[model samples]
Target: MRRQKKTILLASPRGFCAGVERAIEIVERALQKFGPPVYVRHEIVHNKFVVNELAKKGAIFVDELDEVPKGATVIFSAHGVSKSIKEQAKIQNMFAIDATCPLVTKVHNEASRHHRKGRHTLLIGHAGHPEVEGTMGQVPEGTMTLIETLSDARNFNPPISDGLAFATQTTLSVDDTSEIISILQHRFPEITGPSGEDICYATTNRQNAVKKLAAKTEYFIIVGADNSSNSKRLVEVALKFGAKNAVLIPDANSLKLNELRNVSVVSISSGASVPDILIDEVLKKLDQEFDISIKIESSIKEDVYFNLPPILRTR
Candidate 1:
């Protein structure tokens, strides 16, 4: 029987944003400099593959500061931690290295500035996400309110209307966040916001690439961890942009042949935290099942790069 022909459209700028790259590098460098059993406050990034790889290199993942022995080294996750966590690290006397992405750090700084200026801040993000939790912790408990949906934005009534400001999780859906921001602006005309859009450039570019690919592909697959916000957003963006079917898979191993049996034309992309090696795995798997033709669709060229922490610079 003649094998069926399938076209796989791959989105460019699909995996490992500059921030994720920097975070992983920090962990690897820390392991080399400080020796094994270097404690990490959380998963350096959201991907299981990434965490597992780092673990093999002598990194220890812990949920809280209490887990670390006094005088040991600790590194914070790419999702920035709150003020309290910083204070705790200092008190514990742990040699702490911040692996938080520079972009997320920017949002944290904005939140702190807003609080200092007495602005009743509103954060547009999903509840319980590490990034959201970390950002919220930047200010006093009651100072920042979380606005997760359009309904939340509509019903929100600030105690002091004139002193309102807003900041958002760096990985949120650009389109969805815009709607919430729009609603907030409508309700509170005096509300202040960050000088620029909080969504990172890599996120916006990846989403834009997926949006274009979704229009032409019959089915879409987003390769990323379930907990990763940007990866999940790409799945949503694909479905919203017109793909017939879209799903989030952790890696190439997660794909079911049955799902792609009817999908003649498919598009594949990975979340920001994903490594390109996973994307290659998926492509290899697809090639085995069908006579595949590959096309690379790049929406934009990303030239952004972030440097490692200052402590690692001299190493």
Candidate 2:
């Protein structure tokens, strides 16, 4: 039998964006500084591998402040949290550490500013997402209205003020967000928004890189956990950009050998929180199934870094 060869194209600037790195570090450092049983209100990031590792190291995940005992330390997820959550933590006397990504924090700040100015806050994000919940939680109840689609933007009506401002989840489809934003602007000409939109640099850059690769690749794979928003977006972008098929694989074990039966070129990118090791394992899996050649599809180089909180910051 003549051996068939396959080619793998790895996307640069994929995985471990600054925000995810910071959130994970916060959890680890909390474990180091405060000892075991440190409570994190949600998955520090949406990657199961990362969460499982932290769990092994003494981090406890809970859905609410009530689960954490009074005076115990609790860290917020990178998605940010609502104001009511803060008040609840204060009332319980639990020590609070915020692990919200600074980019997400920018949206929170924008929402707060809009609230203070009496403008009804319109949040552009999916419902029930931790980031949306956290951002909306930053203000009084009913202050920020969630708009997930262009229809939602068109139909939204707020009481007390037509004065409107908007923010968005950091991980979202750039093309889709633009449509939603346009609908809001068209419906309410005076609505204000943050400069350059609320989607973070990492999300935008990764999606852009995938789009660049999808045009020429026969198949595309995104390395990310199922619950990860940015990882899901990468798959969507690949399909939209002309790849024959785009699939998300959590790790090497999840990759299906049979699917690559005759695939010629594959483009691979990882979610911002995913580790490179996961990608390497997937490559090995591919190699085991067929004679494989590797190529690096280079794009933007990212070096952004975020500082830890005062508690973890070195003097």
Candidate 3:
């Protein structure tokens, strides 16, 4: 009797979005240019493996700006930063490098534009997320409100005009965000919006690929840290798309054999911050545990590259 082969479908445009790439490059270049003890305001990106690797190279991660010594080089996380954070950096006389994703910075600029135009803004994103916090901080505390659900949109009242505009976190659920945006538009028909979708192309492509592959896959696995919103979204999208079992394990060590007990087809993807090396590790473990075959189901090809900051431009 021949054993049945388990098929694994790999999603393309899965790991390391453009923003994450830029953020990581910023840190690496800073290390090369300035040498060791370079301070980072937050995890440059959320993946544990990336953070640990950078830490090994003397990149110091701190939650607060005060932790950074005067004159030390501090790099902001890809999620952007609050106005107060930039002010504090200046006050402390620290040399700062912003690694905030360009897409996120666009939303921040939109928030400021809306506030300047005397229009109250509704920020659609998860609360307490660094991106959300940083975007909301673009304006005064009372100038904008955070809306996480349709209910928030339903009850939200703008202090200024009904002709409101909105922005979102670069990493968010494409489907869920659309529904929330619909609710906002239904409530305020005069609401203004940006010409382009707020979520980055990499995030959308990954989720779409997961959604397409999950239906045919018995089990779905996402390689990313627990703190990664985009990584978590991939798991949720997979589950929603009909995968019997879906999980987000940081790496191979976190995978459980039981999850694959009856699973004959597996789909895999990684978050924006996650590195391909982690995915490769998981693949190696899967190869040892099961008779697996590989398939590539790519939704789109990604060729986006963000330029390094001016300081590292020559490098």
Question: Which candidate has the top score in lDDT?
Answer: 1
lDDT by residue for model 3 (12-39), tens:
8799999998999899999999999999
CA shift at 238, candidate 1, in angstroms?
A: 0.3
Better of 1 and 3 by TM-score: 1
Model 3, TM vs. native? 0.97
**Which candidate leads in TM-score?**
1
Ranking by TM-score: 1, 3, 2
Global lDDT of model 1: 0.92
Q: Rate the local accuracy (lDDT) of all candidates.
A: 0.92, 0.89, 0.89
Clashing pairs for model 3 are none
Tens-place lDDT per residue, model 1, 158-198, is 97757999999888899999998988888887889975559
What would you estimate as the lDDT of candidate 2? 0.89
Misplaced by over 4 Å in model 3 are: 1-4
List, residue by residue over 1-315, the lDDT tens digit for candidate 2. Answer: 655688888888799999999999999999998999999998899988899999999999998888999999999999889888988999999999999999999888888899899988888888878898888888888778889988898888767556888888999999999999988888888888976578898999999999989988888989998888999999999999999989998998988878888888989999999988888889888887788899988789888999999988852
Off by over 4 Å in 2: 158-161
**TM, every model:** 0.98, 0.96, 0.97
